[model samples]
Target: MPITDEIKKTLTDPTPLYALAGAGDLAYEKLREVPGKVEALAADRQGAQEMATAKLHEAQGLLAGAPAKVTEAVTALPTDLKVLQERAQGFALQQVARAVELAVRAKETYDELAERGKVVVDKARPQADSTQADAAQAVEPSDAAEPVAEPADPAEPIEAELLDEPPAPKKSKPRKSAPGVTE
Candidate 1:
């Protein structure tokens, strides 16, 4: 429980103390990168200001053209509406045709799977019949007069099986070597 002088010296040894010293050196090197960060920050701020000015000019241009654009849209409204209605009707017909095509494809797939299932059943039918016939032949009476052992009583408890088993094997201990020279 007592701390000795040797323990104190080991804990205070400088050979193991350079981790913090190396860290301090690394921090000084990283501080050299600060000027680059400041430059980048200045460039970013200038870029953001230029982008804001350009967006303001673009917004002004749009504003100047707004009245003409509105007049053009109002004049062409009836023609645009008719075109949109025709497009919508065409889209509906196309969707119906696509649905019919998909239904036909699905029915084809179903029919193909049904045919495959029928082929598999036909191939397995003879094998199943032969196996059943073999099993029936095995169940027929045997000529040999071998004695049949009666089944153990189901009423017996589980402890009876455990009691009949042999004792478990013991773990072996390691042997001790003789003192002096080891080969």
Candidate 2:
């Protein structure tokens, strides 16, 4: 095909036009979210400015007291570092404890699932074996011809023969008398 024909075919196809319209709709949805995003950013900027001002005031107060506390802080440095180290160790220990607890819970879950799986397999195994046996019997040829049993429908009730007696016959409807005759 010529390049001009190919270009004409592409322009005439409705799929590309539908895709453009979809893209336009998506862009419109995104544009609609812009105002909310702008408002959230403005609020965040205000919050950050307030936090910075508070930190600046706190720093100024600390600076005012620095000279008087310098010697005391210097003397307490080793104790402060030891306390920080103990806290870090405590946090690490807590994390380890949580990991152990999670492992124990996972083990319990695995064991429960394994037990349930075993029960399910055990229950299904007999039914599967019986079906296999039935299939095998069907495939085997016998010297004597025996009637093949039809698959029993569980919805139909099984008729059991009564001891030394046959089943009662089904009842028939009584004959209607003639219109003028009295029975």
Candidate 3:
């Protein structure tokens, strides 16, 4: 008769069709439960994202205030300029040595960071170049492509002009050979 009556009849009958009907009903019930489950998962993900964003903002705020906090702490320390200068003078030599060491270390650190940055930039350069080339290709007509102006060479040497005055006279030096070393 109707589809519902047919399904009911098939469910009641002792046949493979009856098992199929039961399975279909179970599948339908599962399908009905899916929206609620998906909504719950989405809400959980949204809440996690919001929490992460809040924590990121808090960390940024703290980092932004760090310099001011450091300044305040340094100013609060109980030491006058004259006393500090005298104390510094007492350890002047040691301080100079330490300063030299720190300078060398900072130079090494800067060199390492520069090298790493160069490598990263080198890796990205080809991709950026290709993207620019693609854009250029898209914009230019095929017939005019051959005549497209080439980029000026970046390593062109500067033209030197002659100076009006002659260079200063070189000073003479008295040279002596080392006793044990040959030159």
Candidate 4:
């Protein structure tokens, strides 16, 4: 007979061997549930590991892009600053030239007025000497015959002259970057 048939026959007697065999069968049935539980736990553990690996890869991708992003940002700064510096220099030179021109023109004007005053003084001196001789020859000097006051100094009048030209308008610097560009 088969071993299963022999065991069944022995179990019918309700001896220690029959009790032990029945307990073994119960243990075997319980043992069978273990594989299903182990497979489920293994699947869950594998899923968790896969998720962690995916997250790690995502983090690494971002880290890898960081250098390139930093390089782009760094490169842009100098280019922007260079353009600004150039524009500033240009504006400074323009203002300096304008100021110098204004000063030179004012000096020329002063010199011309000084020359004209010298010419007037030269013409008036001889006339004044002749008038004084005529006054001494008169029998009596009247109040109207008193010498006229000398003309106001030409230098003083020129000094008082208002500035002929308005100051140059300030130059505005151009924007370094286009409107939508990121810094």
Clashes of each: 0, 0, 0, 0
Q: Runs in model 1 with CA error above 4 Å?
A: 1-79, 141-183
Stretches of model 3 off by over 4 angstroms after superposition: 1-90, 144-183
Over the stretch 9-71, how does candidate 3's per-residue lDDT look in tens digits?
Answer: 877754443334445555677899999999998879978899999999999999999999999
Q: Which stretches of candidate 4 lie over 4 Å from their true place?
A: 1-81, 139-183
Looking at model 1, the pairs that clash are none
Measure candidate 3: CA RMSD: 37.5
lDDT of 1 by residue, 1-183 (tens): 356978988887643334444444456778999999989988799788999999999999999999999999988777677898998999999999999999999777555555555555567779999999899878875668556544377666666567689999998998777897575
- Residue 46 lDDT (model 4): 79
Quantify all predictions' global Cα lDDT against the true fold: 0.76, 0.77, 0.75, 0.74
For this target, which candidate reaches the highest lDDT against the unseen true structure?
A: 2
Q: CA shift at 160, candidate 3, in angstroms?
A: 51
For residues 67-165, write the lDDT of model 4, one tens digit per residue: 999999988776677898998999999999999999999777555545554555557769999898898868578888788544387556443234565
Candidate ordering by lDDT (highest first): 2, 1, 3, 4
Error of 1 at 95 (Å): 1.1
Q: Check candidate 4 and list the clashing pairs.
A: none
Residue 52 displacement (Å), model 1: 38
The better-scoring model by lDDT among 2 and 4 is 2
Q: Can you give the lDDT of residue 59 in candidate 2?
A: 100
For candidate 2, write residues 1-183 as lDDT tens digits: 699999998888655444444455556778999999999989799788999999999999999999879988877676677888998999999999999999999777555555555555567779999999999988996658867444389665544323347768999999999999998
How many Å off is the CA of 138 in candidate 3? Answer: 0.1
